[model samples]
Target: MGISDTSTGILKGLVVIAAVFIVLAGLKTATNILVPFLLSVFIAVICNPLIAKASEYKIPKALSVTLVIVLFLAIALSIAGLVGNSLNELSQQLPQYRTQLNEEFAWVTNKLAEYNIAISSAVLIEYFDPAAAMGLAADMLSGLGGVMANLFLIIITVVFMLFEASSLPKKLHYALDDPEMRLSQIDRFLQSVNHYLAIKTVVSIGTGVAVSLMLWVIGLDFFLLWGVLAFLLNYIPNIGSIIAAVPAMSLAILQLGPAAAGGIGLGYMVINTVMGNMIEPRFMGRGLGLSTLVVFLSLIFWGWLFGTVGMLLSVPLTMIIKIGLESSEEGRWFAIMLSSDDDVEKYHTAK
Candidate 1:
């Protein structure tokens, strides 16, 4: 390229990068307030299915909302209870685990002795130090505190959002003074969101159950944890399964020793490969279309902007953005670029 063109390209790239950073900083700031509300809205959408089913049984709308809310809260409390019990049990076993770890370290040192690695137990202990491990535990607890706080805020937001959900469209319509058109747009937006959620929920649950069963049969330390990871990560397209597998494999190695760990890791790899590469593609089809590049870039963008939770929500959030863009004439090209080529062709042919 010519110098002038190269210089222009460099300048444009810098400007774009600066703009992206500014937007990311704004998003990070907004997330403190927006995350809880967005989470609540998503929860309300999931519960809408149950609410509709209840309406089919001739239940009043208000009563159906109330019923779903109660059921949701009950499930939340039960999960909290289970997590609490698990935490307590883990705390009690901590010392025993530490001892086991020390023994394992010594065993490793002994085995290495045959290789002429004359490492003393004390030296090995120093190298394999538990102090850093303790520090990690502390950090984890601090993170857990933040997560729990976020969880409580999310629940509060969800309750209020659920209470006001049915009236929201009407309120917006009245305020806009174009009730029918506004309501129609709102309805379409909601339908798109609901469709995305339904597909995501089914896919995530299926992946989680499959992973959990595999882990359980293989005698992994925490099948449930891996299952939960699978479910949460399934929302992230392309790389989520890989990210989820790392912790599962690492923890397996720590708990089950290398041979068993290898087996567990292989199981995870196989399951994820089949689900992520093959089955998911077949099932997702073209309706909630997203491009491979869009999916990968969304992972990096959202993950950088909002941490682990953002990574988990990346694809859905991107899909939602794509849907919004698709709904507008001027932005249709952007939406098309975000979709699979196959889907774009289908859309064009249908048009």
Candidate 2:
């Protein structure tokens, strides 16, 4: 290559690196601004059906919004209360758990030693480091003020969003001067988002309840906390079920002995297997056909971008992208690639 061409290439590389860092910095800054509003929008969508139903009875939209907000807040706080109680109980028994955990570690080391493999529980612990874990947790807790402040903002925004939802379309129409087109687009967008959220919520609730009941029957401590965890982590997809199962199994082992732990683990596996393999497929009936790699990468990317909230929002965000692509002819090919064969077959049959 000529010297000029080489210089141009180097310039391009620098530009690309600069662009990447700029984007990352922008995202980190924008996260605080966007997260709360996005959360509010999701909450508003969840309550949309109730708002519409109440409006059919000639209830003013404002009153409907107020009622929905009150009911939602009450339900949220009740669940939170249960979780808080469970956490307090767990804290009181931390010494027991700690003792059990050390014993378990010793047992594992001894078993490995039988094969002539030497392992130090202390060394293993230093490598796996609980102190670091505590430090990270302390940092998160220290940020509680900011987290709560943003959460309060989200709630206020959501309430107003619901209240103004009815008039939003009219305002958009006036601004755009293309009412029908804008309305059609908005309706489809909302429908797609709402449908996905509805399905996810039902699935999460079922998983949480099933897991909680199983733990309770097995005489595990903090059943409510595990249940709430199962419900929340169920939003993560693929890896979420496994993540939710681990702590419950640990608690079972620590409290009910090895046999109970094994049984609880087996039961959890069965529940997840049945639901993930059979029930979810029957209800969802083929996904929008996102590539498995794409789905996983998006999970990681979005999780990094927004933390736990991003992970919870991952699938919906991916679905939104899929819908947008499918809307245009050029992008239809991408949507097709994302679909499973069964979904394609079903869609064809329906057509």
Query: Model 1: how large is the Cα RMSD against the reference?
Result: 4.7
Q: Write the per-residue lDDT of candidate 1 for residues 1-351, one digit (tens) a residue.
A: 699999999999999899988987898988766666666767877787677787789988878777787788796666455545545655565566567767887898889998998877777556544334334323333333455567767777766776677678768876976677657756766775677666777778888899889889878755775676677677777876776676556555556777886887787788777776776667565435777788799989876776655665677688778876866787888888888888789779969
Off by over 4 Å in 2: 1-24, 101-149, 174-182, 286-291, 328-336, 339-351
Residue 227 accuracy (lDDT) in model 2: 80
Candidate 2 lDDT tens digits, 238-277: 8878877776765666677779979988987888787776
Q: Number of clashes in model 1?
A: 0
Which 10 residues in a row give candidate 2 its minimum summed lDDT?
136-145
lDDT values for all models: 0.70, 0.72
What is the lDDT for 350 in model 1?
A: 64
Per-residue error for 5 in candidate 2, Å, reads: 15
Best by TM-score: 2
